[model samples]
Target: MKDFNLSYGHWDLYHKALKDEQRHDEKVQEAIKNNLAHLLSEESIIMTNGEGMARLPVRSMDEYKLRYGSNDSSQVGQGDGSSAVGDTIGKLPAQSQGKGEGAGDQPGVNYYEANVSLDDIEAHLFKDLELPFLEKKENGNEGEVEEFIYRDIRKSGVMGNLDKKRTLFSAMKRNTIKGTPGIYPITRDDLRFKTWEDVRKPESRAVVFALMDTSGSMGAFEKYIARSFFFWMKRFLETKYASVKIIYIAHHTQARVCDEEEFFSKGESGGTICSSVYEKALEMIEESYSPKLYNLYPVHFSDGDNLSSDNNKCVELVKKLTALSTLFSYGEINPYYRQSTLMKVYEQIKNEKNRFFIFKDKQDIYPALKHFFSVKEKATS
Candidate 1:
């Protein structure tokens, strides 16, 4: 008979058994391996003592090796979506005992176990990681929750030190009740003081979306800047908002969706129809997200060098997107030496309110992001 405790590490029992026996047992070794594999197969494995000590399972350690490497040095290090996939090994759900040991002299039943995969575990965990920091406050009348990205840091302060400081101050204050009677006139028993009030500050929630053209003319520099911009903006939005969902669309003759990895690394080399991207984004917003419910913002990064007569369609697309989103911005990453005709069409939109932005280089991204989230003077003051 084999005994196993989930609290202890897998190798712990194995090594102990081996040291005691001094001889190798092939069957026992195989059983241990199978036990570990079964543990790995379990989804949502949480450690009793919560911390980074949790085991995150990946499809296979071999898969991780292929993407990164077998060596610890080959870790993807740190980035926005680096730790996205993994298997989490932890405790099993509580089970209740059956009423009778044997079913009225009938045979006993053994329940079969279902093995879970790394992919299944990752998909399960991703839902929790989606904006874990922000707490939701339900809005009155509407079912929609008022989402804020702010954190209440004061709620987790050191109370022990605060108590000691308060006690010392109280004793000092009592000694001076009769007006600055210096020296240790106050007794420790007379010391009575209140605890410090916690501090909390309001944080802003702003979401900025970047739609970049990955076509050939943009060059390596442009692509790099675009990836960095998205990464930075994602980090910033995370601080202020309860959630941030980044959608990447690469359009040439038409627009199709891409994940973060494909969006940053994929290169461009096809005819341009800028309107296709806008249309798809509009559909996505309508299907998954509503304008008033979310802090909606859309930014399009493209070269001013679009097809000669497609400007009208582009303007129509802008109008459609602006209607759906809170603020729509067009950032033209002009790298080629061509006429800036793209700017002209967007400029004619009549309404100057949050419509277009044309930039010459990468340095403009910061300012452009600021402008995108920047409130008007009346709104700011």
Candidate 2:
């Protein structure tokens, strides 16, 4: 190969282009953030092509060619065939309408599509929401958890626990003082071992009870709204809590504990008895999650339809749960179910305005989440 001197000017241009691309990507991300609520809606989630993958639409600037004027001023098209300055010379093609058919040669507005994972989307969605009253509970016992944490060093310990370098130095010093220099001479007093103290750490535990009214009144759209809310709620809680346990309870006239897959997918038909799920949730919390040990969060999603006779019982259960839980949130999914007995019953309850929410459509999901995460103020009589 012939001797050649490489020019670094192209490298500088490449770096500048890379920085411009990065800035453009950030602008696209900001655009996505502005439409985050719409992107997280039920329609968007359903339209996603893959699991945990979402297509985000971003507005992008179209590439334009810059025209430069000549240094010498001259009017070339000022002949008799040319049109006047104010008159239109030629007509541009009309823009296509919404989802129009047929392929056109004309350049269109740039719309960039970015594929983002659900985890990334959740990070943006739950940026400001934080769990309140997160306090360390009782100290947990330190067992043989197999965690190698250097606690302390001592003079006596097991052979495995011996600090080899320290022990060798001590032995060398002792040998020098006694004038008995040997290659591997080590006395019992010259041995220094590493000691470990039991580290008692406070465990911050939290449990979330996701209760859904799977009665016949809750249509597919209503269930979708509830499931979307729960999906975001679970993602947000996982980010906030160190230890989070989610219990999915579905109920019609009776309630039963189920897995998350079943909770969102399964459909049941029966009379709406809102108290059954609340009672089951309370029982599970008392048995498994102690109020003193775990911060409890009981979230109920319903269509606001409940038996008139069971409304009082539901209210009582909610009152008890609110007293035990760190936060109690109730989300009514159906807009037409406004005159529901359950909603009326909850309206009679005191000091739950911040926690209770009404979600009419997919648009209401963001507001409902804000309501759930909003700080509660003390209520006066």
Model 1, span 118-179: residue lDDT tens: 33333322222222112222242123325334332232344443344545566667667867
Model 2: residue 96 alpha-carbon error in angstroms = 18
Tens digits of per-residue lDDT, candidate 2, 1-381, equal 257654322221123344355555676568667877776783545434215556666566444687787655532344467666787654432342333656755566666666656655666777777665555565552121223567777788888998988888888888878887643688788888888766544457778889998899899888888888887777787766556789999999999999977886778898998899989998998898888778788889999888888888888888988899888888898677456667777877776432777777787888788778656565666
Per-residue lDDT for 127 in model 2?
A: 76
lDDT of each: 0.53, 0.73
Candidate 1: stretches off by over 4 Å: 1-208, 335-338, 377-381
**TM-score (all chains, Cα) for each model:** 0.47, 0.66
Residue 88 in model 1: shift from native, Å?
74
Give the distance in Å from residue 228's predicted Cα in candidate 1 to where it truly belongs.
3.1
The lDDT of model 1 is 0.53
Highest TM-score, which number? 2
Looking at model 1, residue 324 earns an lDDT score of 61
Find the candidate with the highest lDDT and give its number. Answer: 2
